[model samples]
Target: MSKLFNWYSGLGLATKQFIYLFIVTLFLVMVLAYRNLSEAEALLKNQVIRDAELLVGRTNQYIDASLDNVENMLLLLSTRYDLFEDGNEAIAADTLRKFADYNNSIAKTLYLVRTDGKVYANEQVNYDIIGNPMLPELYKLALENYGAINVSEPYYSTMSGHTLAYVLPVTDARRQLQGVVVAEVNLDSLTERIAPMIYQSYALMTRDGNIINRLDSRDKMLPYQAGAYPPVLQESFREQLEAVKIGVSRIEGNHHEMLAVVKSTTNRLGWSLAAFIEEDYFYQGLQQLNNNYRTASVVWMIILLLSAYLLSRSFTKPIRRFVEKMDRLHDVQIVAKLPVTRKDEIGRLTQSYNDMLERIQTLLHKTKSAEEQKKEYELKMLRSQIAPHFLYNTLACISSLAKQQRIDEVRDTIRSLVKLLAFSFDKQSEYVSIEEELEGLRMYMHIQQVRYGEQYTYELDVDPSLLQYRILKLTLQPLVENALFHGISPRNGGLITIKGKLEHGVIRLYVRDNGIGISRTEARKALHDQFEQERSKYRFTGIGLRNVHDRIRIHHGVPYGLRIGSTPGVGTVIRVGIPVLTENDERLGIMG
Candidate 1:
């Protein structure tokens, strides 16, 4: 007993009680409920049988009304004259339109068949023969019996598509066959009508009894059981037809063996309309009620757990407050006044947390200050290196050409070099006008033309108005240098293309190369690592690409950078997306 109590105590007072209720009281309640469920199912079965009988009666009345409507319309067509005339189809159509205005669901237009079995659709001027003439079976039966009635039978129409047609064959004064009046009704109307009568009782089958879903009716009346005529549907069909003849009625579970009342609709065509629900499947209210109970029970269990957690948190609250206070405190000591004065485990925790935060603040200052200085120094190094590196290379190239007796080339190089240096050396502000940037690029491109001697090509397609927009200084030079060094140099001959424009309120600047193309793997690496990973794996390095990525990050925020796409043996394209100013950049405009 003591061991059991200890085990129960370990799970907490609430959970131990929940387990005991689940095993003893819950188990007995479940068994009793199952027995009750059986009794309830039997009771529901009896009630559904009663409900089915009632629904069947209403169903018979509805079907009869629908048939009477179809039959009355057909009878009116028979008494009408000029129906046998050459333009009789038009006359009948006119009659149908008058009826249609009275009831919109009933189309006033009429299709008819001749005494010799010719079918005509609509009385319009463009009447087309639907199919090869066939004898109207319903008309022949009505004529043989001499009964003035509406007949429906299965007939295929090519114009309106193959269908079970409702025909009203009406004769003239001399008992001469005038024509057959026809209406092709949607068959789903009959099937769907009987579907709602029985809950979970649904079936759609033709007169010949073809089941649509994959199931072959596993459990049905013995009469509907597997037999030569497909026993699954036979018994229900018989019961439905009998009910139609003898008022709505429910068949015994032993004979028809169906669960619920069966409803059926037979159009003028004599096609079977039958649907029935199985008894055991009908009453879902109890099952759904039991499920609601279980859901409520689980929800209550979660609520109990949350309540325990909140109770435990009474002790944990002061420690949590101390941690939050420590996080908000920057390079400073935290001295919190204790909220819980209760002599418990938590009050001591609150006192200790305040002491720990006070001690850590003293030693962290020198280390944080040193780290911030190191980042600033690294940024300075990168900034200082860009200008001298370009200037030294440009001046060296001019000097080398001058020594080789190429004074004109040297003079041209120096002139272009001076313009490039002026743009590079300018530190008026962090941002420069794009017009000045383009001027720098043109000078650089001229120097390349002098040295490479048509080996390199450059094109600048930029919006004229966007020239006054502010752009990061020296941003375009690295990209242009990359096109020369990494792209075109990779192959013996190539083309370089540069295009820039403002699209949809953003600047899209692109540089494409037709050279030894970068593979998709290389492009992903360039963008992902900002080309740092590219330097490790491939022969083509990514220094210029990395510099562009860093500058864009420093100017913009995260997520904006170079996107490279290429396929091996094709070429690489670098598209740089940057936010554009909606109006003329006020700062750049003022500086200008």
Candidate 2:
């Protein structure tokens, strides 16, 4: 089954739908047809039994009417004095002769007999029995029965073949038994009378279970005994028969089945009528119905399979077109919109592709502009690195003399200037350790201290752990230079504080001065001096500040940069925030 499914799935969409629809339609039609046929069979069987019951009833009525006419004639004649009075033998014989001739269709012969079992008058075929005893046992029963009519069991008669005799006793007004009148009912003639009542085979049975006349010759010789039916249907048949005097029932056999109905005669005939049909014989029309159903199903399956193929093609055609277009889209900007436009999922996808093309063009233009700006900034940094060499040579000469003369202040000042000049000339690396940056700031402050005497003082308070962390060079020295010149130069006693700490995974360094502070507007200009058209108009020239800001922004993103806060009467604090990075970060961490 799995292999069959794999083979089915490998087929094209149209072919697969065709096969699936065909199989499903066939299965559904077969299931429905089976159910319909089963129901039809049940209905047909019930109709057959109903028809058989009606036939048995009609046959029973016909036989009862005939028997009633015969019995009424016997009763009328038995009470008559003209036929049975004393010294009326010849009249009785003539009367019997006329009665037999007129009712010859029902009764084959009629006879008059004495209660002593002697035949007195014989109507037909009675020449040999004129002086002999006639049906002695039956006549004795009639005598013992007195005035009531008595019916003998079926017997084979020489004159009339198989027949049943009805005997009525003749008596005086006091009910004394005088004689008996006998009428032999011919079974062959009775069968002929009821032959037109039903089309199916039928049988007439006596109360003692005798087979009087069987319409089906095949079953005529088979004697019906007690519990004669198959065991599967015996109990049901007996139950049906016992529930009602006349009803229809089904009887199943090992290789065959039958529908039979029984009806008892209303008149005193002491007989019942039944009709039956075999299953195969009854269901011949159903076989024709099944053939017609199968033929129609085949035709419809073909029609539906063709329709399914067309529908599957219609459903997949658009998807095929979309795939072809996508295969040819080598360049996003040059691609055109799809020609087919319907507001479905495919339409939305086409629109999204068009939007993607526009975004790509915009991103490419911005990327080219950023590349040009980066080259210009590199050129500017190179030009700024070419500083004056004469200042460095002179500071080296002064530092050697101050050390030989033992002038501590002059020697310290020249040493600080030499260190600052050396740090500025080295242009290979843009990032330096925090410790080197702090050392640079300390050297610049020492020169300021020698220039301003005891009025200028500076202190460094920083976390020792952050000494090895990398920061852009010249970040702190510029801020300290600006504070001493702009902030401390105008004050009598001013102090500078450099603080460094790590907070929330960021390195924060602060350079604050306790001097005559600039206004909020002046501090804002100092931070944004690069954007101002006239840069020299601000008190702070901002060359060093802008360089530090640009370097920090170029290395980190815009979020990590320098910020300034100042009040009119209070000092200014410049804070630099950058991601913490050390020499070990190259191997173990992601740097901003």
Candidate 3:
């Protein structure tokens, strides 16, 4: 389960949305389809049972009508004195034959029987009626119910496969029973009369479970037994038949399930008409309906999935574009504005992002301008400090040389001073090539050498490749001057070694002097612009270590600035760190 959750969490927003929508839709569709199918199946079963019941009812009515007709004919014949009189036996037989012929659809034959058990049938006998096993009981029933109609239980005969005897006793005018007129009802003929109403297989059975007429020929005139016929014709179904005049049930049959409906006829025969329908046949239409519903549901699900995919894409497309833009934010000079293509939340987010970029650009422009002004002011201050102080000292040195009458020394000192002034006064740019700055440093050192005279020596050890790279003007000169006056001059002699190198992506320029070095506390103060007042008087210019540090920080950022290291009575090293940039690189902009 945790793994499933992790997998799901890793999916993109669009895929997650699609999965969520599909799952919910699938659940709803399944539930709705199941409910609908269940109801439809129930309704279909009810319809099948209702149809079976209707068929049984109609067939039962037809059977009852046929029985009534045969009974009526027997009653009409019972009133004929010719059928009961002894001398009118021929007339009775001829009358019976004609009556049987007229109602042959229901009656198989007619009989005139005496109380002594003699039988006269309308047709020549295929079987002896006097010797028939049912004759005594039927005759006794006719005698006991004198002048009333009587119906015998079904019996098999050679002439009629299955037959029921409808007996009507004939009496004299004074109500004396002479004989009984019997109409042998062919159950098969009765079944044929109502066959049109019996759509499925059926049976016409007596109240005692005798099947008088059935579509199955093997079961004629046999008592209904479980499993002998359809499995539904069992004891339970028989009990149900007795309980209700019209009823239906579903029961398992021999080959398949069956829908059975039993309807008892409202006649003296007390017979039941049961119709059997195969469950598969009954629900065939419903099965087709179910198949169609399933097909349609699958198609609908496909369409829903497609729609979910499209909807998810529609929502996530803008967010993907927004993320791409954010990735390039720091890599580009200007932040690009995203287009607001909609009035929805994503569009509002895009609008907000564009607004933020505009604000950032404005802040950066203002910051850059302010930093440039600060650097310009610091440069002016450095120039101010250099002009009067250095000019006075150089003029004094030249005057002393002239007073000594050293013409060659005077000419060299004046030429070096002129070169130093030219380098300092030039204001074409605040940044200059390393080679140019080094040349200016050489001129300044020359003037200092004339003043101190053989006290200190200087060395420039720089990578030739670094000469074309740009640095702030007078950046190295202030440090060199501090080394000269504070270190070399104080000791009356020292070696000032100026070194420049490239390390990693930055330029490292170091100035070292083998003279009396300041303590850690004094070095920290000097770098932070907290130098003592006494030391300030000896400084060559107001552009000290602190001024140079601030200029580097303001222009190139805080990481690129001066680091000071010193120990008392040993050498002091001031290392200047700045990004490496050539004359062609953009100054005051992003480093190339």
Best by lDDT: 3
Order of candidate numbers by TM-score, starting with the best: 2, 3, 1
Clashing pairs in 2: none
lDDT of model 3 at position 493: 93
**Candidate 2 local lDDT, 33-134, one digit each (tens):** 889787878888778767767777777888888888789879877876445555877777788787877888898777777655445454533545443334
| lDDT score at residue 82, model 3, on the 0-100 scale | 58
- The weakest ten consecutive residues by lDDT in model 1 span 533-542
* Superposition error at 419 for model 3 (Å): 0.2
List candidate 1 stretches off by more than 4 Å: 1-397, 400-406, 528-530, 533-543, 582-592
Model 3: residue 558 alpha-carbon error in angstroms: 2.9
Once superposed on the true structure, which residue ranges of model 2 sit more than 4 Å away at CA?
1-340, 361-378, 385-422, 425-428, 450-454, 529-542, 587-589
Candidate that would win on TM-score: 2
Clashing pairs in 3: none
Q: Rank the candidates by lDDT, best first.
A: 3, 2, 1
Tens digits of lDDT, candidate 3, 293-332: 8898879888998888987787667778779878877833
Which candidate, 1 or 3, would have the higher lDDT against the true structure? 3
